[model samples]
Target: MEGQATLNRRNFIRLSALTGGGLVLGFNYFLSSCTTEQGSGQAFDLNAFVRIDTNGKVTIMSPNPEIGQGVKTSLPMLVAEELDVDWKNVQVEQAGLDTEKYSRQVAGGSGSVRESWESFRQVGATARQMLINAAAAAWAVSPGECTTENGMVVHKTNGKKMSYGKLVESASTLEVPKDVKVKSEGSFRLIGQRIPNIDNHAIVTGQYKYGIDTKREGMLYATIIRPPAFGMTLESFDDSEAKKSAGVSQVLRIENKIAVLGRSTWEVMQAAKKIKAQWKDDGTLESSADMTQKLHELLAKAPKDKPRRKDGNIAQAFASAAKVVELDFDAPFLAHNTMEPMNFFAHVKADGAELHGPIQLPERARKRIAELLKLPEEKISVMMTRMGGGFGRRLMTDFVEEAALVSREAGNIPVNVIWSREDDMTGGFYRPMYSYKYKAAIDKDNKLIAWHHHSAGVGGSASPDSFPAGAVAHYQVDTHSYETPVSTAPWRGPTHNYIAFSEQSFMDEIAHQTGKDPVALRLELLEQAKNNPAGKVNYEPDRFAAVIRKAAEISGWGKPKAANIFQGFAAHFSFASYVAQVAEVEKQADGKVKLKKMYCVVDCGTVVNPSGAETQVEGSIIDGIGHAMYAELTLTKGKPDQTNFHAYRMIRMSEAPEVEIHFIDSKAAPTGLGEPALPPAGAALANAVFAASGVRLKNQPFIKSGLFA
Candidate 1:
């Protein structure tokens, strides 16, 4: 464990050389998800990491992180469909880090679905073509007439067919298809249908290895003690008492830090607590309270860091408006709180290093490790384990880098670094807190005349401002960012989730003021986008209205359903898909909002798996609801305030609402399903609560702001 030794590194998963490394390449895909395989002979390219073995099992080296968006199943579904393989017979393997194959494994900004779907399809189509070519040669027929159906190459006219497994050996010898025609929507047998998750068996049985479960022979378990505050380096450490403890191997200072290595993780954790690690609290000039105060002030004068969208003259219209209303809303920082804490296993070598862990950004982490370890790109091997829950938390490589650093410190010996519950919580990185200010005017005709919106926040520095102030007549959307030591990445719907709560709530207010129904008001604006127009809204007005109408029909809108249960609605277009949500809420005497039910309608063009899409949409609604009501990651004096499940909360089974999701029938090519439904659900819930209580909740974690009261 103390020397550079790896017994079965090659036996585990061998890497292949790359075909493309750095060329400005627009991603090309077929019927699946994203294109990742170009193929080469060397034993380590990222593309080669994705392979169809002679057994006909497709090992999709998932480039995207899988905290729990189900990319592990959905992404491969894209490939399996295009490959014309039986979804039941397919197997997906996590990929090692290889950017030559994966360009954007950084999973955030709701780009996972729209970006990777077609590309993965290309990989399948290419493989399918090769298989068909093999079958054609074997049957001595033209390749044109041979089509694929459910993992078999069928002589379409003759009805003779061969399974993918039967043709694997022959297919491997055929020239890979360079420009093969992908199957049309009408010809698909799998792309738009409901299918079970491929990895569901592994997950249900706990056989799914996460980053925490990664182990190696002669690998030492270790724990790290980082500085309490950002920008603070280790001043000194005393591990004499820890080193003498049972099961402890050696407590050595590596890279100006103290690392406790032991035989077991429990032992290392015990030894880690005894080590008196101290450092100067070199943090920002402001505390959490200080930051809060500054954020409120900044919300008013949200500096013009960037203008995301602007059209018409709000100032000119506001100067001559009848009535104007202004409001400010705030949201605190949030922690990912993945069921599994951050962990990684690495074996650093002089020539290269092999790393495996629970990480979202696999390709990026590999490159970061390759550079941080000071080895050639070819020497680094990064592998992914199924993530317990990603939620945009696993997209960073900080923990992976630390593991590699410690492995090199241990003389390039194989080591698995484990982060305790505390380490995982306070380790570093968070969703940035935010504040928003809004001002809108009502004309004499009771119509919206002017709109001005400014949003300032942290954690969103890496996110693109996605709201266009909704489908408004005269609108302006302004955005700005604040710098903090807290590292932040994408979280589900990112900015749209928060903005939806704010913007959609404001839309409801305007609708009430204008004597128009909430749904009617949205329909009017959507009508504008449909008739004359605005710029990009991935959502077509008719399509968006279709979901709203469909959800309204299912929700019994405008009908005498119940006196206590109130309904509210919101719709949004994101990640190249449109989703509309109608929420039913009932107030409780305990001052908590009980979600009675939620109806969601989605139109994402072609559904590869209708059942999968429905499940994802339901999960998204619950995910957004739980985070909106109870999830908040605050800090005190540069340290995390919540460390474990007891303090942090997630939507539990009994608390989750009955989510009914319906899909629209469409012939459009296909769109994404991962995150499109998340944003509007939170907003719709808030609106429903407002209708019930006549209260407009502005801040996140509605319970904190007395939404029920």
Candidate 2:
């Protein structure tokens, strides 16, 4: 199955003449096993991701979904950089779902850039070499004698030049090189440069089309009424009044939800409210409080444990310690409230099906929709539109599946299923609530001697081998999980987001208890891991220390500050990247804690598109701080208490702090930047709050418990 999903180019390039006597170049990759050509009567199979026209215009297809991550611009930049084409002459188009031609066409886990860097650069380098080969032949010179610059190949000796368009026809006849040399890091012109997003004008001018802005001819709108709580069954419904409502077209049922279709979205939403549905749910539903209590009970009972890592005798180390410190931490469930609520458009027919929306996992959606419709994968087409935000929520295909099911039941008519803000907020699939217990011991010499952590949560504990695990001489990690009906999935950095808070905060507590600087303590642990490691350390200690040192230097970690201001520090490694943060917090006279600024250091190997990297870092910090300070979801009887933005507060502009991000200089293989910066922000802020107020916040949403008051 994995081999079938891989992308391979089977056919060579095909050249044709355009209507204006311009040359058109097409490269095709076979989608099926038989290697048959697609329509248009082309003899060779073609999957054109890059096309050069006679008019000196280059069009590149961005193979990943653009979920407000600047991938649409950054991915194409990789191709254009290697193609040696002028950025101005390039046009970027979003590719439809084509797993056969493009591998991993999704946009979650910050893998878009990391996964596509090599293949995309290779694509451009191969094309550039071909164009240079054509120019070298025309100039009666060796390929090495010719060089490319700004979309033109020039012979340095004679200064003879030819545009890429002029060589397309000749290049098409040549064989695709199996191995071409891509430019080295030092030779990169566009890769590291700060290029403006290609869609900036369209976005600022209100011309960009998001999922909500998509429209089709004769398309109907729909709104689904789901059960208020999980495990509820649709017992009965009365849609007679909804059918008579204004502009109401049809009232139907699909799966466990009832749908109201109308000519406009407003009409459908209004009609949905009028339809009365009777749901039958078991009375033994659990709430957030109940779940939290259950987790505590499980922890106290010492339920069956899955030991992740164990080193020396922890009991002996603790028993020989001078002092021991223990603490309990709890974090509530969270909701992914994307600005644009979950919406999708689908049209299913006996022959084929089409789906369009802001889906992060298009390939997965296509396969699932194919199975749901009882059709082959090739019979379905999925397209992605610009999304307001994804944050891992769009990774799920439930909304797309619902849209397809509704479209099929609605006489195969094109239908756009829209979820109101309330619907989206109250929907299932949330960040699972978690509870953690941490204990540490210090020896007579004030050296860390023992460490133990036990965690319990809905989806299981986050990565158990958290940082400092391999650094300690005697370390052990145990986890217990409780199965619940509540749907749970990855949220942003997934496990790292919550785990960083618990681990980093506890490390800070250890620092305070040992009379050591928090940043210095982490540095010492990293040094210990590098020099004399206890077990197999998964992270690079040098790289980890580099970021911590850099963040401390930039933030003036030990410098004295104003009376009301204090600093806190934290560092973490996630998504194959290392990040460290120092937060400056101010405790207002009224006891509210305010973040004044933050200094961040990131080491994601090599940087791609510095501007985009910075934007991602800044955004992740704000998102992290927002959730840590004010965002949380509570349940009452297995139903979300927060309905929309009014109740589910986000970080306001006034509350946002200045963030300074600096990346370590390296030419190593680049990793992801989207998620690594976030995990540390929560810990850094919490530690800073403690420094400012002389209080330890063991629970999330610090404001909920009047910690700020």
Candidate 3:
């Protein structure tokens, strides 16, 4: 439970000072930290920020690129928390490219909340503290008595109040205070309160600008025609007709593909349609069927366990079992499918390059652009725009590099290269598909004896990286990997996403056979984990049991419910947060699933923005259910099979279940809300479906199971 906690006020002040003008925002605490900047004593630079004039118009410098994860508002809330200001008065802006003003901005792993929580807090708190100090000096009273509220300091004795804007000049002159006091948990007024998303207005009104909306002076639009498969190379291109298309300016090949540039994105699309480019498939084809077989093989041939934690002999216990049952579960590959597709505006001049895009990691994008241009990182600038959505896809900077290359080829006249929906779907990079085989043993009394679980995943499809792998004992882990034509990277919940389905479903089977309550059955396993567990360093049994029991009670388990709906339950600990989900669903007479309701309970320590955290948890659970119910990617001859929305499906508003989230308000430091709630919802739904029907559905997309039953 203890590691390096989030940065504090002192650290934030130091980092802000180095970055020139510091940025401050309140992000929910959920960003995964496996790849966070993990060094000390290195001061950051702050040239990319601009705090508003003292008119109470605070323009926050946004560091992490947001693609609909609500960072535009959520992140700024953190700053407002320490600044002692109301959330309404704050105005926010996207941070431009500058290492001096930011740290690593990679946005994957759902670490956005926890990763930037303290640093940004310090920025807001430091500035506000200084402002209060300035106000105190002006009032000639101790700051202790002059409380700040909604950007104004009130000298209660004198009944005089002044806005933070009135003290900016004086506050800016103050030296950075070391270790400024942060608000205690009980004192938080805005942090744990419900506030609408900061960008909600812009988004609803269409005023919000994403990377796809970016335009520069004399900017040209580009759509690239890369090889159909990953690792495939471009062999040749005949652009005679493409150059003749209306508004087409140039056709150039860069980074193993031909880019068609034109005066408009539409023109570029038209021109690209005309280009007849020949590609030689350098990568081998990997159909879903082929990959599925390879996945099973890998699961069966797993190697020695990594064993981050251990408890007892899993093999010995299973060998002595009075009953044993085995099952396999599969999770398919997925896409980020951000509303704003991959696009970046880059103006590569003889001296430098200016890049603008919706990206997760600005540092990575900057570095990648620098390398491609053969220029120094300092010479390349990245301007992050508000993302339409992230979902861990925009974290890759390859799109940025592609934009830079196209801009360079266009003679550095600011050019924005955009991917069509088809391009995004077939281009490359996907959530790795995964498979899990679970076997459980029980005694004559129907008490569980032992369990053996393993995975078959390629690339990034493994358990949540934060879950200590060596924590389990009597565990065996082996991976079977074959080269895939598609690229792979992290998705929401990463590996924990799939493992939850398999493990929770298998656990449900145990409860069903023994006539024990499902939630109680899991508590029993947590009890075993408490005594002689499978891993040495797995989760604390008490905490795991706490979430399960809490979820059951909060969900009104064993209580009466509406007609035609059955409840299923599951619990998981991920992203440093514990979550339990109970899904209420109905199988319609026509065979379509109606997800009537979902009840989610989460314990993420101190609740930061209760509203924001709840929203995140709700959305994540929906995404998990959506993926399990319907979402898949396939390939043929190394070409992506699904080209757009028609083939690749997502949970629509019509199909989205009604979600109610309950947060366990713990005094412990807050964890993340982005991904922990996602893992169990799928498994919970699966268990619920089985409860309704006599048949046990073992596959994902229960619809896939419907065919057999």
Candidate 4:
């Protein structure tokens, strides 16, 4: 099987005239040359990203999947902003997986906007310039004399005007320009504005096509009965009863799981429950308790450590300190718990394979499916559906691969494999449980002198460049990890999710022990990092301090607010963005923490869409706070104890607090918004809980530690 084809500017873009008197701009990033040959006869390329009909209707292909981060709307805004087109006249179409045409279609790391900002603008500007040049040639005037506005090319001196559709034929004949200017940020009409999601109407009117809503001719529904625990394999199964159930068509064993296929999803789900399966444990499995104990043991042994960063002499500084504060923090494994469970549709045949699903990485999935089916990469096609939620879980292609395997086993029939909530919740690839041991020293002058951090987990080391690293004179970071059979993958902010909680909470403790304000302490350290830095700092200290000050000012930090309300603040930088959050909490008579409000300040460079950026920050804060307050996945003999919402507690609407978000105003290139806001939220909420209850909750999932009780 051939690997993914390389993409370059020569083959990445093409322009051609449409048969119906319009223009088609083909942009190739993922598809191979063979795939392009399929549409050779047509005037327009088969994978044309932009199509303008004779009637002046414009269609723009959105390359990335819409995973609820509003890429479908935000990305197109970039194109339309540069294309000089009205949003109402433009329609967005979701593009299929094509690595050669769309180089970075995968939607994770909050990079959709950050990565697409320049390329998408170029795509739009290139198209617009073609139209303007075509209009200039027809008018026998210089292209400089023509200006475009709202899909119309106009002559400034005269009243001559031409619709983009009318100039398409001429534009198609002109050579593709080597250089085209994009609009200045100050002149952007759509990029910085608050644009409603293009699919809002379809979503509200129940016309959106999510993966679960996918259907095809002769498609069979399937549900697999997987192992109840990790390190366990299928030993035997009796599917006779399932085969006899109503609507049951076939019961097949694929790999280590049994698949029950039927004519309907409900029937297949019902029949799947009746199939009795037995599994044998590998005997190497351990419970979450054992894993936690193992981490503690590793910390105690002071195993051979990999030093991530070292500065000055930590031992000497600690010995000379007037006061030393040390603390240990632990966070348990967590499940993604996406609103929509894992699902995919696949049809495998002798000639080729087709897959449609909500996935984060389609190009990677296409390659994996090709390898699994023993077919060439070009022989497979992958389509993306609007995802309900990903949160990094969809980055894994296991579910999509399963659908393909099941379809092949079902004699090349189209199969849709839908995972129950239990299947998704109990599935592996969870956020690894992590433990952090932090020690800080202060001089007799009440100045922070030394900082040391040791982290151990199943996956790998936590981020070592966490804040205060470059603020202290003697700072050292060490990591120790142990391998486990259990799988782990990125969850939102990944390492920052847990590290922020531990590090920021420890900072709060330091502030209390030194009789200093928590927010002020962080600001002072940031100032130190800016002026007299200890070691190399990856983040911009100025921007870091800006967000901290902004958050404090906006949240009324150190000011008297409503009675009984306490505020806590925390900040962190990740993914090239700086985020700071202030959480407001109130303690009730029942000893439970009631989150009242949250204030967030973000410095993600340029803001593409103000409303969308605000929404993302707000959503991230809620997600982070909810997980910190009451979400954890513990393993019992390597089997997830939390299977459903009943066991895995989620923050309800009534418990959700009012979130106020503000973004730093700047013209710098935009960074990502999805993951950066999350890291600080957990720390801010944890700090707030401490302020309100006068009890420091060292462990995560505050509910698990009886912090509320």
Candidate 5:
């Protein structure tokens, strides 16, 4: 495959005059086009750019926010790879939300690398070509005779080389080339190599600063006391005792909550604990039992909305089937539980507002703060800090808004609003609770005929077009939703996270009931999809099959292993990437099942930063398994049951299975890796548990299924 296609005219390139002595190349090949500044005739937001200094140092600006996805390292590799620079000579800087200089700056959906793959490469290649043109001009030779290697422009005929830094001045004066060609796969040196994460050294040495560690001059620490439970509203508050506490400066009511401001976090926390607040339910206070009961009722009733997807006849196919099997799966709400919790620093004044903190959507946060503080967007500046963890929690700017509001309320004295672990767990948004009902029809010849999936949840919970849809002849998917006071947000893989488990586990059950090999059954369905697709296919069937086959081969599926060892397999496609996972479990003599190891195969196109990609896959698998095995959040009378680590369990190092990751070799453009590997891990483990115990787990948190001691 070509390294990159020819650039269109609309994807313009420009040479900017930098005050410092260096070559600066601004290029735009953005997936989404942003308007250029009026009368400037140049696209300011070029997606990415490269700056070469006189010291032979390369500074590449990363446009997107980094949330531990290793984009800080992998994205710059895209530029350095095409720039032909040695890894040691390159440095990366996180670009802020400069609409005129950056585009696609958010950190959600794992689109950072995928979106910038081609464009960033072009940015580097364009600069390299400019430098070669300068060298060719000096040598009085054709530009075609010059090639770049390790930051040097080489005259292949005379064996003469010129450092990029030496030609920076002449290169900056030259016109930007439009037809610059990127390197092919065979020429890649920095990419597909095991480059360590750029922040690894700082992270391990405790020198990296997260948003929670943010501090500003004259900053006051604030701890808010919002409604303790959902559906409740603050009736009144008495802050006389809070004001009497030592170090407590002020206690004021903001909206429905009281904000305790002090010199230190501990003081504010203690002072807030002394306040007397009364809350009353403004609506029906709900419990977990009530939500589960409502879910059952909705799934049992016919969906009011039209089916998300439909192919062939569903009622007739099941009615005419030789045999049918139905099963239900349930999942509970989960807290994000980011290590740093929720914190942001904001100083909102009449003229402008300065916001600094960790946020996935820095642009969105800036706009929200501007709207709330009644300031112009240009007047509000938002800077992103390295986050401790996101997991989709930072996508919501509520915490950032709270900090801005508190700062404004505190007389614009630069306040940092922080949430305690309890505040984060009890009040933060969660993954919507879900229940799925799957029914499949098998023909007399034991061939799968039809599939009907019904899911009901607090919000949407089904991916209608995701696999099994285009594979089955008669397929239909319906979803039922109910509104509640509970808050829900996008978690890791979002809908794919839970849907894959239910869908893949149902496939395993069908295979067992029909006396077919699970792995063979999936491959057969994939073949059907390839040969005769039922409807609009959103994924590449060949790519999906490749991962499945690779996973089976690596796990030694259907082959004999150690005593009491059993295996289960699952595959899913999400974020434009395909992944397959095989879970290995050991059935102990005590009748308990232990997950020993996991084998994961991914086809995310060309792997950039092999170490980072492997780490992402491994972390995703561990996160998926941890949530599937132990995580659960429940409510009683609108109050959370578990608010801290002592009550809410996580997968420990002892319980975490050893994960082996493999990526398929492909020349296709790279895709997202942060989420694709997560969707299949739960299902693989669930299937393996059944293979060992002969008991099919139908609910989330397999630990609660009585299969483990």
Candidate 6:
């Protein structure tokens, strides 16, 4: 708090004396959270992610993108919790892309907390051990006799205490502890407690700086004019007229698009519109109808290759079953529609490049920028800004690439590239349109004998190990993919977002056909998976069952309710977490269904920052429900028909239902909370609508299905 902390080496940890005595700690690991795998067994380097001053002030670097998922706050709590420091004395800063310093810095798939749980704790625990060692040396006592509490080292016998600040000088001279004990779950103070987001005040008071707010000296605003359609290639462009526009500083062509730079966003946008461009269709223009037909054809035929997962003889089971239920579910392409449109600021000097903006994958962006500028990876530095909203859009570095390209093309002038809402919506990288064909065979006793699922989509498919695979005795999963010019990427829960709706709704249909309760049916399947798993199970059946059971009990699953109100239930496992949701709907006087309330139960292991955890669950539910009810993105001749929010149709504030969230108490390591709750929301809502009315919804954008229209 009273001295400056500095890094002594490029990628090594060293503690040296400061003017007033400051402490800095560096941590490095090969753990990648992008997937379910743990450490890569690769060599590690040191990078400073924690710094403390002699005044007892602490600063921690949050190495993941915020994306409104609360990682900006919750991640730091992990370090502070292990350091035994007061939350009031801790401040968090966003870390940039540093391969030597951090791993899995990208924020997607809800892996931020899960992947860092142990490594971040080690950082604090190791530091705390050093401080205690220093205190014991000063007192001439055993290190084990000293403990830490609220940034202070205490001796139990004499009841003497010294602030961690006082031990900094001595700690700097001590050897690093290879293994330091971490606090038990029962001893955690800040983890389970309800702590507000670190940036709550700044976010609410209009003081937060999102990527769109990025500013630098002599930075020119820019916009791009891309081909109107996905399959169209730029043939020619005339920007002479655009160059005459006021404030239009420069106009240049970059690859397939033309960039217009000016003093203001409005001027650049207006000048970009004045450019005359010619696009030539490459005989690959795709329409929504084409994609739909392709999916239908693919789903209709069995693949020639082996199935992704096959447990038993599915054909024989279906032929011998008493009854077979078959259905098809469809979900259209969806755009991210982040509040702050894609924007990035880039300064590409002759020797190195500096990029500042909202990017979910900063390391990936840095690597690409280095390649584009023909510089070494170390020559490129990326600064991640607080994002307005990610939901997986910022994971693509197209905007960042555009800014860097424009900057370099404009003679190394710092430039900020901004996308209009229309541009953001029309730009590719949407949630791929998906279709699921499910068939279930039921025996005479109403027991499921077999399950068969076929999924077809444009550049996507269902998980082979997803639920019901290990529950049913005979099961098979086959996926078919079709190539398209339109680009697609992960959106929130990715495949689970649409697959959960289809899977859970079909389960509901099975219950309705067999005259059994829906909740009871799921429990029965979970029990089978837990006790006698039929195949490889990727999730904890017991933990999954816990959330399902808890949600049922809290929502009064089988109990009586008020008239005109119907309830539905759904559960899913994703991102190493489990979530079960119950939706309540009211039948209006005119017979239309309205979402009344939502009850969600989640088990992401130990909860860090309960307030932020609740916020994530609530936001996921609203987002899932909003998209299922109203959001839609369609393409006509490879061009998006909906270019802005008006045509895209987001959920209105008044339409958001009341939400009640419950988290199961657990000692398990914290998992992901950002996405698990979202996958089940659409399914729960659709099932609720069916109970309110005898309608079975199969398509997404329920409003278009005429149930709520």
- Runs in model 3 with CA error above 4 Å? 1-56, 172-176, 302-311, 464-473, 530-534, 538-540, 560-563, 587-593, 707-709
The reply for model 4, stretches above 4 Å from the true place, is: 1-21, 25-41, 46-48, 589-592, 705-709
Task: Please list the residue runs of candidate 5 whose C-alpha ends up more than 4 Å from where it truly belongs after superposition.
Answer: 1-49
Q: Compose the digit string of candidate 1's lDDT tens values, residues 420-525.
A: 8787777656767888888898888877766787777775731222433445567777776777777676777777767777777888888877778888877877
Please give, for residues 282-311, the per-residue lDDT of candidate 3 as tens digits. Answer: 647567877888888777774455642233
What digit string (tens of lDDT, one per residue) describes model 6 on residues 406-454? 9999999999999999999997589989989999999988899899999
lDDT of 3 at 523: 75
Candidate 6 regions exceeding 4 Å error are 1-13, 16-47
> Tens digits of per-residue lDDT for model 5 on 561-592?
98889999999999999999999999989989
Model 3: number of backbone collisions? 61
- Model 1, residue 70: distance off in Å is 2.7
TM-score of each: 0.87, 0.96, 0.88, 0.95, 0.95, 0.95
Worst 10 residues of 1 by lDDT: 1-10
The most accurate candidate by TM-score is 2
What 10-residue stretch in candidate 4 is worst by lDDT?
A: 1-10
**Local lDDT at 333 for model 2:** 88
lDDT of every predicted structure (CA atoms): 0.72, 0.85, 0.72, 0.85, 0.86, 0.86
Q: For model 1, what is the C-alpha lDDT against the true structure? A: 0.72
